[model samples]
Target: MEGNDLQRDGVARVLLWGAVLLAVAAGMRYGLLENGLLPRDCLAPGSPVAPCAFKTALVQSFLHQRLGWVSLVLGGLAFATAGRRLAWAGWLSGLSGLILYSYEPAAVGAMLALLVLARPRGEQRH
Candidate 1:
């Protein structure tokens, strides 16, 4: 029974790492798609950015990308770890990653958090 619990814990950690990576990729895609773009013709070398494009930003796009990257590294650590405590660490990272990184499209947010919570946080065999 103990062995089985450890095995399950191992699996959970991996899932959390996967979620972190997914969040990073999603953040990048969204950030690039929505950026400040000057009008096609209203550029003179250092012209101000157009209003329509600039206003499109939600600030979250920029922040989420950075947060996502950090979360991924933390997730990786969690994945490599084999203990219940580490699993919780990964879960926390995933939840925070989801909160800070997820934007209007909340599906990813919920998914990331769920994955972290469900993933195997292994046990340290003493």
Candidate 2:
């Protein structure tokens, strides 16, 4: 029973983290990237505007699909090693990438992470 409870708690935490990351990614996409003044202000070279550099970096990351690749890698690691921490990392990155315009690999990574996460704790190798 205690083990079951621990598993439930771990699952809940993973879900909560995914939700929070999704929310943040959504906010970044819709709030700052799409319909916000940041992009416009960032057009000027060396704008020195607050958040301009940060937004640009994020945009670059999105364009390059860095998050999606990282998530996929982490998911593969988790799947190969059955490591709980790696699974959590994959899940979080997958959720973020899904929201940040990296859906293809993100979906596969998220599926792998979920599979690892769903395993019983006792059955997990790590």
Candidate 3:
């Protein structure tokens, strides 16, 4: 396949934006325990109204932290590298985001990352 490689100019811009999202996710994962949308902590806590205490939550949160770090690294790589390969990395990163939602971030981050990956290919172009 020819892939999306016509020129590599857009990847860096995309990566820069993805980097911003990653930083945001990182901040939320490390700082926030509240989810405005959900009425309950799905991870469970000592009290229903209290923050999470489950080892599962702790583990998931750590995984999310790692995802943030990976996103940051991938963003830098995308910015530094050329061609559609960067887009593939971004696409993969987004897919990963969908799987990790600690601090309620991954869903939106996944969408944004997909945009970064697909924009140059007319998937998001306006």
For model 3, residues 11-55, the per-residue Cα lDDT tens digits are 666557667756765454444533442234454445354234343
The TM-scores of all predictions, comma-separated, are: 0.32, 0.83, 0.32
In TM-score terms, candidate 2 sits at: 0.83
lDDT tens readout by residue for model 1, 9-91 = 45555455656765765564454433423233334575556543443343343464644454455445544553344445445
Off by over 4 Å in 1: 2-64, 83-86, 102-126
Candidate 2 residue lDDT tens string, 1-126: 245454454777777778888899999888877877575666778876668878877877768788888889999999998887899989988998999988889888887988788777766353
Q: After aligning candidate 3 to the native by TM-score, how far in Å is the CA of 47 from where it should be?
A: 28
RMSD, model 3, all Cα superposed? 10.4
Model 3 off-target regions past 4 Å?
Answer: 1-64, 102-116, 119-126
lDDT of 1 at 41: 35
Best by lDDT: 2
Candidate 3 achieves a global lDDT of 0.48
lDDT-wise, the better of 2 and 3 is: 2
Off by over 4 Å in 2: 1-9, 41-46, 124-126
**Clash pairs for candidate 3:** none
TM-score of 3: 0.32
lDDT values, one for every candidate: 0.46, 0.81, 0.48
The alpha-carbon deviation from the true structure for residue 7 of candidate 1, after best TM-score superposition, in angstroms, is 18
